[model samples]
Target chain A: MNVLNPHLKFQSQSVAKPYFVFALMLFVGQIIFGLIMGLQYVVGDFLFPLIPFNVARMVHTNLLIVWLLFGFMGAAYYLIPEEADRELHSPKLALILFWVFAAAGVLTILGYLLVPYAGLAAMTGNELLPTMGREFLEQPTITKVGIVVVALGFLYNIGMTMLKGRKTAISMVMMTGLIGLAVFFLFSFYNPENLARDKYYWWWVVHLWVEGVWELIMGSMLAFVLIKITGVDREVIEKWLYVIIAMALITGIIGTGHHFFWIGAPGVWLWLGSIFSALEPLPFFAMVLFAFNMVNRRRRQHPNRAAALWAMGTTVTAFLGAGVWGFLHTLAPVNYYTHGSQLTAAHGHLAFYGAYAMIVMTMISYAMPRLRALGEAPDARAQTIEVWGFWLMTISMLLITLFLTAAGVVQVWLQRIPEDGAALSFMLTMDQLRVFFWLRLFAGVGFAIGLVCYLVSFMQRGRVPAAVEAPAAVA
Target chain B: MSETFTKGMARNIYFGGGVFFFLVFLALTYHTETTFAARTNEAEMTEAVTRGKLVWEQNNCIGCHTLLGEGAYFAPELGNVFHRRGGEEAFKPFLHAWMKAQPLGVPGRRSMPQFNLSEQEVDDLAAFLSWTAKIDTNDWPPNKEG
Candidate 1:
C-alpha cells in the first residue's frame, strides 16, 4: 500500500492538532453522560439527587454541541490554511479563542450542575435578557454573548487567512457556512413574550444550523477529502460540492416548515414542511452517489484506509439517518403520531453521529496521522483499530435507532392512537416501553465500548505504513 | 466526458439559493407571526400569564417536560396538561399535590423535585400551562392523555 505524500508543507496544519485533541476529550465526556441518561430512562433514578436526570441530560446535550463546535473550529483551522495555501493569519489568536470558548463552555456547564436553575439564572444575569431554558440554546444570556464574540473572532481569523492567499472553492464554501452559523445564532437572542413566535424563530437557530448552512460545511469538507484521497480533479469535486449544497439549501430552508406543522404556526406549514423536507434527502443521496463514484474512479488510493472508511460511512449513514429516516416521519400526518416520540430520538442520534460527528472524525482520521507521522501515514495496526472502532460505534448506533423506532411505533399506537374510548396514560405507555429502553441501553454500552477503542486507536504506535495507490480506472 | 458544472455556477447557486430560500423562510415566518395572534388569542395573556411563563423558564421545566412536543422527552408532555387533566379546576389541585410530593421516595420510579412553589406561583404556573394548552397546536398529543 505504498503511496505518495500530499506535497504540501505541514507547519500551518499543525495548528489544528490541539483543538482536535480537546474535541475528542469532550466527545468522551458526551458519551459518558449519554450512558448516564440512558440508564436513568430505565432505572428511573440512577444518580438521583446528585446528578438528576435533568442535569445529566443537559450535560449530555450541551457536551455534544460544544464538542461538535470544537470539531468544526478545528477543521477550519486545519483546512482553511491549506486551501488558502498560506499559514494561518494568527495561530496565537486561534489558540486564545479556543481557550476562551472552552472556558465559557465549561463555566456554563458548571452553572447548570452546581447551582439551582433559578438561582443560576439570576447569578448569570439571565433575567436582564432571559435566554436560558430553551432546548439546545440553554446558555445564559452572557454566555450567549460570549459565543457571539468567539464566533466573530473565529470568522475574522478564518476570513483574514483566506483573504491573504488563494481562495479555493472549499474555503469559500466553508466560510459561507461558518458565517451563516454565526448569523443564525443571533436568533437565540430574540425571546419575545409570544411563545409561538419564540419557537418559530428558535427553529431558525436549530433547523437552519443543522439543515441549512451546516450542509455547506459538511459538503465542502467531504469534497476536500474526496479530492485528496481519490485523486479526483479538484474541479470535479468542487462543482459537486456546490451542486450538493444548492440542493441542500433549496429543500432545507422550506424544509424547516416540517417543524412548524404542530407548533401552532400557520396551517400551510403542514403542506410546505412535508413537501420540502421530503426533498431534503436528495442532497444526501447525491453525496452517496458522488462518494462511491469518486472512489470507484480513484486515480490513487490514499494510504489512510480509516479516512476512506469514515468518508463512505458518513455518506451512507447520513442518507439513512438524516435523509431516509427523517423523511419517514417528516410529513404532517406521520409526525402527528411520532412527534416528540422516540422516533425523533432515533433520527437525532443517527443523524448527528452520521452527518456531523463522523465527518469531523473523518477529517481527524485523515489529518491526525499526517500530523503524528510528520507527513506520513498512520501505522497499519492503528488504522485497523480505528476501522474496528468505526464499525462497533456505527453498528451499535444503527441498533439503537432501530430499537427506538420500534418503541416509538408501539408507544404511538397505545398512547396516541385511540382504542374504543380511551388511550393509555403516559406512565402506562412508558411501562410498556421498558423493553425497548433496555435494548437501547444495551446498544449504548456497545457504543461506549467502541468509543474507548477509538481513543485507544489513537495511542497505538507502530511501524508506519506506506500509502496505498488504487488501480487506475479502466478506460 | 468533461465536467459540465463549474465552480462559478456552484458558488452562485450557493449564494443565490441560500438567499432565495431564506427569503421564503422569512415570508413564512411573517405569516406565522401575523396569524399567530388569532391562533393563540394572545390578548388573553395577562400579567399573571407573563409571570407564569417566567416561572416555567426559571424552573427549567422544559428540561424535564416538553411543551408542544419540543423539549426533552424525560417527562410527560406538558403542552396539553391543562386539557388532559380536565381544565383549570382539576389541573390546579393535581399540579399542587404533585409538587408537594417531591422525590416521592419511591425507588425505581421517576420523581419530580418540589420547587416549593407558592400558592400564587402555582396558580400562575397553571395559568401559563392552561394558556399553552389553548394555543392552536392543531390538536397535538393526539389524545387528552398527553
Candidate 2:
C-alpha cells in the first residue's frame, strides 16, 4: 500500500497547502532582510546607495506583515473547515485569492526595491490617492485596493462555509477577527494633510489590529491547537478563549491611548493611557496560565510533542515580550524618554514573534502533518529537531531583546535624560551602542539558523511513523 | 469552576466590554480632533508649510528620521530639528546646506543620500519643520539634540 497518500478529513483543506508553503518562503525572505538591516546597524554603509537603511527596514517590516497575513489566511482556511465540519464552500475562490494576494504583495515589494520611492509614488497615482510613505501602510494605493478585494473574497468563502455548516465559538471568533482585519485596513486610505490628525487615526488600523482583533485570531488558533493536542473538551477551551480575548480588548482598546500621549494628543491621555495600559499585561499573563492549565488537564498524551511545545512556548514569550516589556515603558513618564528608541523595537520584535508569529507556526505545526498526510505527527526525530528549532529561535530572540534594551537604556541615559548643556547628540549616542548592535546581529543570525532547522525538519522522515500505525493496530 | 464558567458568559463579556471600551475610545478621539487646531499649531499651517509636508512625504524623510517621536528611529528626531539647528532666520539656510551634502561617505559613518531638492523645496521643508517644532508636545525631547 502507498504511504504519503492524502488522508485529509475535508477535501477543501488542501487549499491551505499552497498558502502555508508560500508563507514559509516569505518568512525566510523576511528574515534575510531583517539580517540585512541588522548588519546595517553596525556597518553603516554596508549597502548605502543601493539598498538604504530605510528601504531595507521597510522591506523587513513589510515582509513580516505580509508573511504573517499569509500565515493567518492559511490558518483560517484550515481551521474554518474543520470547525464547521464541512468542506470549504469554494476552494477555487480560496486558491484564486491566494494567488492574487501573493502577486500583489510581491509586486509591491519589487516596486519598493526597483523604483525610487518618489518615482514609484508618481507612477502609481499616489498624487490622486496619497497613501504612500506611511510606515507599514506603504503599499501603493492599487495594492491596498487589491488587498481589500482579496480580503472580501476570503471572508465570503469562509462565511458561506460557516453559513451552511456548524457554528462553533471558535469559528465565530475567528470570523469576527478576520472581518475586523479587513474593516480596519480601510483606515490606511484615510491619510490627512494634518500630521497630528494623520497619526491619531493611523492607530485605528495599526493598534486596533494587533492589540484588539488580532488577539481574537491568535486566541482562537491557540484554542484550536490546544483542543487537538490535549484531547480536552471543546467547551472548556472555547470558554478560556472568550475570557482571554475579552481581557485583551478590554485593556487593549483603551490602551491605544499610550501611543497618543506624546503624539500631540491631549494630556489627559497621560492619565488614561497609563492606567489602561498598565493593565494590558493581564491578558498575556492569563494566556500563560491558560496554556499551562490546558496542558495540565490534558486527558491524553499527544503524539505531536513539537506542536505542544510550540503552543506552550507561545504563551510564555508573549507574556514576557508583549506583556512585561510593554509594561516597562507604557507609562507616560517612562515613555517620554523611551518612545521611538530601540526599546520599542525590542518589544515589537518579541511581541510579534511570541503572539502572532509563533501562533501561526503553532497552527502550521499542528495542521501541516495532517494536511500532508504525514500521520498524526512526523517521525520522532523530526519532532526532536523541531523542539530544538523552537528553543534556538526563542532564546536568541530573548537575547536580542535584552541587548536592545541595554542599548536603549544607555542611549536614554546619555541622550534624553541629561540637562540641555550635557546631553549627547543622537549619532554620538548611537556610536556608544555599537557593541549592543553587534550582539543583536549575532542573535539574529542564531534566529535565522533556527528557521533553517525548522525548514529542515520538514524534509526528514524515515519509514511510516509509529503514530500513523497506532490507530490501525487499535482498529 | 468549569461548570460555572460557561462560554456564554465569556462571550457576553467579550461583546459587551469590546463595545463599551470602543465607544469610550471614540469619545476621546473626538475630543482630541476638536483640539487639534490649538494643540498642533494649525493657525501657523501656511501654504508653504503644506507644501513642506508634501516635500517631507515625497522624499520619505520619515523613513529614516522620526517626526513628533514617531516613524523609524534610524536617524535623529526631526520634530525639533528646526529648533535644534537654528530657529527662524538661520534654520532655512542650515537645511539648504544640509540637503546638498550627499552621502558624507566617511567610510564607516552612516550616510544620508543626496535628494537634489530645489531651493524652494528646501525652504518649504524648513517651513514644515518649523511648524512641526511649534506643536505643543508637552515639552518633549528634554534637550535640544532631537
Candidate 3:
C-alpha cells in the first residue's frame, strides 16, 4: 500500500477497472460472432454474404485474443503494483495504451467486416510487407506493428515499476512471460515464400505463446490469487508456481514438434513431437494438484468463493482440454487421421476456454470487487450468480467439446479411415455430422446465457450480514 | 522435505530448464530449415507459383480452406486439391470453372464466393496448388479426397 494514497491499497490499480470493463465488452462481441459461426456450421447459408463464415470466425478468434490480452494487461496492472510494493510507474501511459489498443482492435475488426479481404489487404498496403491472410495472424501488417508498439510500451511500464520496487517471484515470472509474448509475436511477420518454412516458424508464435510462455503467465496469476484467497504462504505458493511453469516450458518448448508432424517438416518430428508433447500434459496435471492442495490446506476463509471456484475450474478443465484431449490425437500416427479434423477444433475450444478464458475470469472475479472498493468480495447474491455463471459456462463448453469430438470421430471414420475407394468426400462426411453441429449450436446458446448471468451478477447489491455468514470450513 | 523445497531451486529449474529446452527447439528448427529445399520441392516452385501464393493470401483462401491440413476446416483441404481434381492437364481448366461458378447458391450447402479472377490468375493458382501437392508431407490425408 502506498502511504500517500491511502484511499486504496494502490491508487494506480484503478486503471485496471476500465481494462476489465473493456475486456468484458469485447468478450461479449467474441461470443456473438462465435454463435454466428456456430449457426453457419449447420445452416451454411445463414448469413452468407452479409457475415461470411470466414469473417465471423476471424472476428471470433481475433476478439478472443484481444480480450485475453486486455485481461493479461489488467492483471499485470493490478498485481504488479502490489508485488512491487509501490505505485505504478505511469497510470496515464497505461490508459493511453488501452485506448490505442482498443481502437486498433475495433478498427481492424471493422476492416474485416466492411471491406472485402483483398480490398482490405490492399487498402492497408499489405503488398508493402504482406503479413495478412494467415489464420489467427490475419490482422493487417500495420495492426501487427501497432500491437508490437503497444506491447513495448506496456513492457516498459511494468518493467520500470518492478525495477524501482521489489521483485517477487510472481512478478518476475509474469514479466518474463510478457516479454516472451512480444518476442514470439515477431514470428508472425516472418512469411517465407516456402509454405513449409512459413508454417514451421508460425508455430513459434502460436505454439510457444499458448503452450510455452502463456503457461508462465497463467501459473503466476493462479499463484497470486491462491496466495490471496487461500491464506497460503507466498514462499510455498511461489515454489509451486516455479515448479509448474518449469514443467510447462520444459515440455512445451519441445512440444512445438507436435504441429510439425504433417507440415512438410522432417520425419524426425514424428518421434520427437510424440515423445515431447506426450509430456506436455504433465504440467497441466500438476496445476490441478497444486490448486486443490493449496485450497485444501487453506488457513483462512476468503469471501470470494466464486474466484476460488474459477481458479480450481481453470486447472481441471485445462488438464482435460489441453492435456487429455490434446493427448488424444497428439501422436504422429493418430494425428495422421485427426489433424485438421473437428477434433482439433474440439481441443482448441476447450483449451482456450479452460486455460485462458477461465484464468482471465478468475483474475476479474478476484480483482473487480477490490477494484470497486467492495471490501474483500462482492455481495452474497452477486457471488452466487457468478458461481452459477461458472458452472453454466464450464458445463456448456464441455458439452460443446464432446459434440465436436463426436463429429470428428464420424468425420475421420467416413472420410479419413475408410479405404480410398470407399471414402466419402469432405462435404458428404460433413453432411453426415449435421446432428453434432446442431448440438454444438445449442451448447453455444447455453454459454451465451451463462455469460448473461455473469454480467448481470455485477449489478446485484447488498452484502451478506457479517455475523450471519459463517467462515468457509477448512478441508 | 517440504522445508527443503525452496523457491531458489525451483526458480533455477524454471530458468535453466527453459533455456535448455529452448536451445533444443532452436536446433530442431535449424534442422527443419536445412531439409526444406528437398522436402518442399523447391526446384519446382516457379515464379507463377509464387504469384499464385500471393493471390491465395490476398484472397484469404486460408480463412475457409485447409492447406497441408492447417487452416479452417469448413472447406475441403486444398493442399492436395490439384491432385484430387485432376492433376497436371485438367486441373487448370477445372479450377478456372470453379472460380467462375460463384457461390453455388445451393441454399443449405456450403458456398464458395466468386473471386472473378482472370484466366491467367486462375492458371497461376493451379500451378501453385500443383506445386504444393509435390511437397513431402509424410503421406498425409490417408486418401486423395483432401
Candidate 4:
C-alpha cells in the first residue's frame, strides 16, 4: 500500500505536505522539551523520575535540529521544482526515503529516551557491553550517523531534481547550504578523547553549522520564498540574500568567542569574543532590513494575509529578540558574567523560535492554502491569532530574558569576587535571582499558550470556519 | 522591451551594493592578526636556553602552566617569571631549586606536583626561564596575573 500510493510520490507537492507535518510535530516537541527544561531549572525535583534533565536537554536539542531540517526539506521540495520548471524526478524513491527517514527518526528518539548513557551493562545482566558513558550525548556517534544518512537521502533527491531541471541562483545558494550541512556534520562523527580539544571540534560542528552555513541556507530559502509569494523583483531578493550571508559570517565567526570565555582558552579569546559578539546583531538587523523592505515594496499582493505577514514577522522578531539579545551577552567580557545563566535562555528562546521557527511556520501556512486549495483566505483568521500569539509569547520572553540578563550582571560583578570564594556567593545570588526565575516560569507559560495558539490556528480547519482576512495591505 | 526595467535595475544596484560591503568586510579582517605577548615558537636559542627548553618540553609544562599567552591558564602566568623570581640571577636558581622544595600537602590547597630534576638540567632550565623573562613583551598581559 505504501509503495503503490500516489502520496508516496517524489514530486515537490508530495514532499511538501509530509515535511509540513514533520516540522509542526518537531516544533511542538521542542516547545514541550523547552518548557520541561525550564521547569527543571526552577524546581530541580519537579519531574525527577519521569524525565531527567540530561534526557530532557537531549530531547530539546535533537527536536530543534529535526524540526529545522524538516522545514528545510519541505522548502527544498517546494522551491527546487518551481525554480527548475520540472516535475520531481522519482516518486518511488522519495516515498521509500520518506519511510526510511521516518523510521530512523523514531528509532533515534527512542534511543534518546530509553538508552542510559552508562550502566546499560550494569542494568542488563551483562558486562560484555562497553559503558561508553559520555558517548551517549557528548560523543553522539549513532545519532550523528543517522543524521548523515538523512542528509544524504534529502540531498540526493533534491540534487537529482536540480541536476535535471533548469537551475537558478537561489537554488544554487540553497544547494550550497545543504552541502555545508553535509560537510560540517561529518565532523560530528569524530570523537576526541581530549575534552578541551573535543570542545573546539564540537563547536566546529555546532557553531559553524548554525550561525555560519545554515544561515546561508535559511537566508536563501526565506528570501526566495518571499520573492515568489510577494512577486518582488529577483534582484532585490538576491541582494537581501548577500547581505544576510555576509552578516552571518561576520557575527558567526567572532560570536564563537563567547563560548570560549570560561573554557580555559587563551586570554585573547576574551577580546575576540567580545568584539565579534558585540557585532553579532548586524546580521539580525539586516534581517530587519530584509523584512521591512520587502513589505514596503509594492508588489502583486498574495491573497493569503496571515501567512504573508508572519513571513515578515520572523525577520523583525529575530532581529530584536535573537540578534540584539545575542549580541548583548555573547561578548566574553559580558559573558564572563552571563555564561550559563538564565539570560542565555532568554537569548535562545526568542532568537531561535523567532528567527527559524517563524520562518518554518510562515512556509507551512503559505503552503496550506495552496496544497488543500481551501485558500482558507476569506476565513483564514488563524493568521491574526498566530501574529498576536507571536507578539504575546515574544514580549513575555523579552521580559524574562532582560530580567535574567540583569540578574546575570549582578551575579558576575557583585557575587563572584576572587578574594572571597565565589561559589557560596554565587549560591546566594541564585537565591536572590529566584524571582526572575519565577518570571521565566510565567513567561514560559505565556509562551506555551502562544505556541498552542499557533498550533491550534494551523489545526483548526473544517472544525471552526476560518474567516480568512482579505489580503491586507502590506505596509 | 517594456518589461519592468526600473525594478530590475534597482535590484541589480542593491545586489551590487551588498557585494561591495561584503568585500569591504573581508578586506578589513586582514588587519586583525594580533598574537599574544610571548612568542609561542621561539627560535633564538643559546645552550642554556635550549636545555631549559628541553626541560619545559619534557615535562609538558603547558599541561598546567601558561607562558605568555600560550599553555594552560590554571597556574599563574610565567611570562614575568624573572621579575616574579626577583631578577635573573635570583630567578635562574629559583627555577632549578623550587622543585626540590615541595609544599607541605595541605588538604584543600592546589599544589604543583614535583618532578625530580638533576642539578645541571635545573640550572639550564632556570637560565632559559630567566632569558625569556628578559625579553620585552611591550606591556602585554594587561596585568601581572593574566
Candidate 5:
C-alpha cells in the first residue's frame, strides 16, 4: 500500500529501546536509595549523620519521583510508537531530554544535602531565609521554578509526539495521567502560611498524585504493555483500560477524604472520606480480572522469560496488597486512629512501591530485554530465580507493612488517656516504637536482597533465537 | 420478563452499586449524629462544650489533641472523654488536676505544658469533653485507656 513511504520501513519498537535501557538504570538508583532510607530508620546515624532527617526524607522522596518519572517517560516513549503506529517526533530531542533531566536530578539532590529546605531557597530567593528552623520543609522559590521548567520540557516532547501521532485508548489514558503529574506538582513549590491550608493544598500534590493520577498511569501502562507481550485482542484490553480509568477517577477524586480525616477538616470528612475511598478497590479488582483473563485467553505460548512473568505478577500483588489494604484504613473511623502512624507507612510502602513502582519496573523489564534483542535470548533458569525474587520482595514488604500497622494501633491505644485519667509520657511511648522499626528494617533487608537477586538476573540475558516472535497485531 | 430482566439486571448491577453505597453513607452519617447524642442527653450541656471548644482552639489542641480520631495522635483520643475519665463530674476535676500538675518528670516522652486554666474554664472544657464522648462514634477508640 505504501510503496514509497520511507517511514514505513522502520519498526515501531525501534524508537522504544533506548527508553527501556534508561529506565533500567534508574530502577537501580531507586532501590539503592530505598535501602539506605530503610536502614537509617533502624540505625540513627547511618549515611552521613550530618544530614538531618528531613533532608534524608527529601532525598528519599525526590529520588523516588525522579526514577519513577524516568520509568514513566521511558514507558510512554516506548509504548506510544508501538500502539499509535507512528515514529517519535525527534530522537535527538528525546536524548537531550535525558541529559537535561539527569542534570536536574543530580543538582536537586546535591541542593537537598546542602540545605535544610531540600534546596528550595537556593533555587528561590527567600528574603527572610530561614536556613533550617525545622518548622516546615521549606525550599527556595528557584528550586520550585526549576522543577516546573523540567516538567514543561519533558511534557512538551511527549505532548508533541502524542499530538502529531495517532491516539489509542492507552495513549489517551497515559496522556491524561502525565498531564496530572505536571498539574499537581505546582503546589509543591511554595510554603502555605496557614498550616492547615498548607496541608490541605499539599495533599493536592502528594495524595492526589499517589492515590489518584498515578494509578491511571499505572493501570493504563500495565494493560498496554501486557497486551503487546501477550497476544490479547485490542478490544479486550481497551475495555479493561476504560474500566480502570473509570474506577481511578471515581475512587481518586473522592478518595482524598482519607487524608482529610485527621487534618481537623470536619467530622463530616470521615464519612465522606471512608465511603468514597472504599471504592478505590474497584479499579484494581478490574485489573486483576484483566491480567488473569488475558493470560488465560492467550492463544500462543507467552515469551516466559523472568521479566515477563515477574512483571505481570507485580500487577496482581500490587492490586491486592496496595488497593485492598489501602481501603481498610480509608474509613475516617479507622484512619482517625491510623493516621500518621506506622499503619499509614504500611499502606504507603505497598501502595507506593508495590502498586506504583512495580508497574514502572514491570514495563522496564518487559521492554528492556526485547530492546536489546542482540540475539540474546534470556536464560530460562535465570528468569525463574528473578521471578521468585519479585514475589519474595513483594511478600516481605507487605509483611513488614502489616506489622508496622499493628504496632501503630497499639501505640494509639496505649498512649491515649481517658479524659479523666493520667496520660502516658511521649518518651515512654517512643521507647516501645523502637522494636517495630527494627522489624521493618529486617523485612526491608529481605526485600532489598530480592531486589538485588532480580537485578543480577537481568545481567544474564543470552541471545534471542531467529524464531523469536513479534507482536501478532501491529495495531 | 426475561428481556426485562436482562435490561434490569445490567442497570441494577451498575446503578444499584452506586445507590446502595450512597444510602449506606447517609445511614451512617445519620446514625452517628443522632442515635448516641439522643441517648446520652449530653447535648444539653452546651455551655461546657462551648468552653471546651474555646480551650481546644485557644491552645491549638488540634495541633496535639485528636477529636473523633482526627488531628494529631500526640495526645490521647478525647472523643470518648466522658466515659474515659469516669463521667461528666470527673471530667472537670480531672482537667483541673492535670493542668495544675505540669512538666511531669517523664524521660523520653514530650511533656505537657501547664495552661493554668481557671476553674470555670476547666468546667467548660470538661463539658466539651463530655459532649464529644457522648457522640456515637460507633464504638471508636476501642479501648478506654486511650
Candidate 6:
C-alpha cells in the first residue's frame, strides 16, 4: 500500500477542501484584478474616479499574497497530517481560522475599494500607530494584527499535530518555513518615522518573506509533490530538499542586501547585494536539476501527468524567471539603470508566477482530483484541459516578461542614459513604450483565458471516477 | 548514494543557520538605523515635513510613485523630484500646482488624479518631498530628470 493511501480517506484532510476552494476562488479574483490593472496601464483612466489604477494594482498584488497564503495553508493542512501519519490536532480550529482570515481579507479589499485611501486610513485609526501607507504593507494595523493572530493559531494547530505523530523531514522543513513566515511578518509593524529608516526595516518583511523563508516552504512542497508523483525514494528527495533550502538560505539571507543598495542603507550593500544576489540563482538551478533527476530516476510512474508536468515546469521556469531574469539586473551597475524600471516589473511578474503561482497550481492539480472525485488523477479529458491551461498561462507570462523587458531596455536608454539633448521626460518615455504596454495587455488577456480554462477543468469531471492506477514499472 | 546528509543535520541548519543569519540581518538593520540619521539628515524634519509625510502616506502617493526607488514605479521617482525640478523653491509651487491639475485628461497618456488637497496639505507634501530629496541615496537615478 502507498504511504499516502492511508490518510487519503481520512476526515481530517477534509479541512483542506475548503482551503483549496477559497484559494482557487481568490486566485480568480487576483487574475481579474491583474487584467484590470494591465488595461489601466494602457488605457490610463479606464476606471477613472472609480476603481482607479492604484486601487486595482493594490488588490491585484494583495490578492496574490492572500491566495498564495491560502494555498500554503491548505497545502499544510493536507500534507502535515499525511506526513505526520495522524489526524489533525483540531479541524474545528482550522475551519474557524480559515473563516476569520477570509473575512479579514474580504473586508480589507472592500476598504481599499469603497473608501478613499486617506479616509480608509483615518477610519482604520492609522494615526495611533500609523502603518498604513507602505507598498504591499498597506493593510491597516488592525488587519495586520488579525493576520498575526490567525498565523499563530495556524502554527499551533499544525505544531500540535506534528508533535503527536511522526516527524518527517518534509513536515519539519515546512514547519520551519511557516514559523519563519510568521516571524518575519513582525517586521511589517516596524514603520519608523524617518523615511530612510522606514525603508531599511520594511524589506525585512518583504524580501525575507519571499527569498528567505518562503523558499523553504516551496522547497518542501516541491519535494513532497516530487516524491508522490515520481515515487522517488523519500530519503533521496529529502536530502535534496535539505541541500536546496540550505543554498536558498545561504544566498537569500544576504540577498536582502540587494534591496538595500538604493535605499540609503549602507555603501557596503553595493558590493554585498551585487555578489550575493548574483548567486541567488544557485538553489533554483539545483531545483531544476533535482526535479528532473528525480523524475528520471523514478522507480515507478504515477498517473498524475499534469501534476508531474507542473512540478517539472515549476523547477525550470523558476530557474529562468527567478534565477536568470533576477540575475540580469541584480548587480549594482545594471540595477542602477533598471532598478525601478519595468525590468524589475518583468522579473517580478514572472518570478512570482513561476515560483509561487505554478507550484500552488501543481499542488492543487495533484490533490484536487483525489479530493473532488476520489480518484488518483483527474479524468484524462480534464487532465488534457488542465495541461492546455498550463501552457497558455506559462507561455503568455513569458511573453509578458519579454515585452516588459524590452520596454525597460528602451526606458533605460532614453531616460537614464543621457544623450546630446536632455534626457526624455517621464511622460515622454512612457509614450515611447506604449507598444510594449499594449503587447503586455494582450498577453494579460491570454493569461485570463488560461485561468478560465483552469477553472473549467474542475467542472470537466467524468460521470464516474476512474480507478486509482497502481504504480507501473518504468525501467 | 552515500548517507552524506542527515535529516537531523538539515533540521539543525534550518534552525541554527536561520538564527545566525537573522542575527546578521539584525546587525545590518541596527547599523542602518544608527547611520540613517546622518544619511537622511533627519535634523531637517520640521513640523511641516512631518505633516507632509503624513499627507504623502494618507494619499497613498507611493502607490504610483517611487520614493527612493522603494515604491511603485508608475510615477517618477520623487526621492529626487525636489532637486530635479529645480529645488524646494520651484518644487513646492510645482507640486501644489501639479496636485490641482487632476486627470490631465490627455488622450492615451497616464494621468494623475486630482486629490483636491488643501493648500496646507500641498505645502506639507511638498515639504516632505523637499526633505526627501536631500537624502544621500548614493546619487541615484543617474540623472536629474527623475
Tell me which residue pairs clash in candidate 2: none
How far residue A275's Cα lies from its native spot in candidate 6, in Å, is 0.9
Best by DockQ: 3
Worst 10 residues of 1 chain B by lDDT: B1-10
Query: By DockQ thresholds, what CAPRI class is model 4?
Result: incorrect
Interface RMSD of each: 1.4, 1.0, 0.8, 11.7, 9.5, 1.8
Model 3 pairs in collision: none
Clashing pairs in 1: A1-A467, A2-A467, A3-A467, A301-A470
Indicate whether candidate 2 or candidate 6 has the larger TM-score.
2
Q: Which lDDT value does model 6 have at A403?
A: 98
TM-score of each: 0.95, 0.96, 0.97, 0.71, 0.71, 0.95
Candidate 6 or 5, higher DockQ: 6
Candidate 4's residue-wise lDDT over A224-322, tens digit each?
A: 667856777877677667656766776676566566554434565667667876777787788777767786783977766766677777787778776
The residue-by-residue lDDT of candidate 2 on A73-118, one tens digit each, is 9999999998999999999999999999999999999988888888
DockQ-wise, the better of 3 and 6 is 3
TM-score of chain A of 4: 0.86
Question: Which regions of candidate 2 are displaced past 4 Å?
Answer: A1-6, A461-475
- The lDDT of each candidate is 0.86, 0.89, 0.92, 0.61, 0.62, 0.86
- What docking class should model 3 receive? high
TM-score of 1: 0.95
Model 4 alpha-carbon drift over 4 Å, by segment: A1-11, A119-140, A376-378, A422-426, A462-475, B1-146
lDDT sort, best first: 3, 2, 1, 6, 5, 4
Clashes of 4: 8
Q: Which ten residues in a row have the lowest lDDT in candidate 5 chain A?
A: A129-138
Model 4 chain A: lowest-lDDT 10 consecutive positions: A127-136
What is model 6's DockQ versus the real complex? 0.62
Compute the lDDT of residue B105 as modeled in candidate 6. Answer: 88
How would you class the docking of model 2? medium
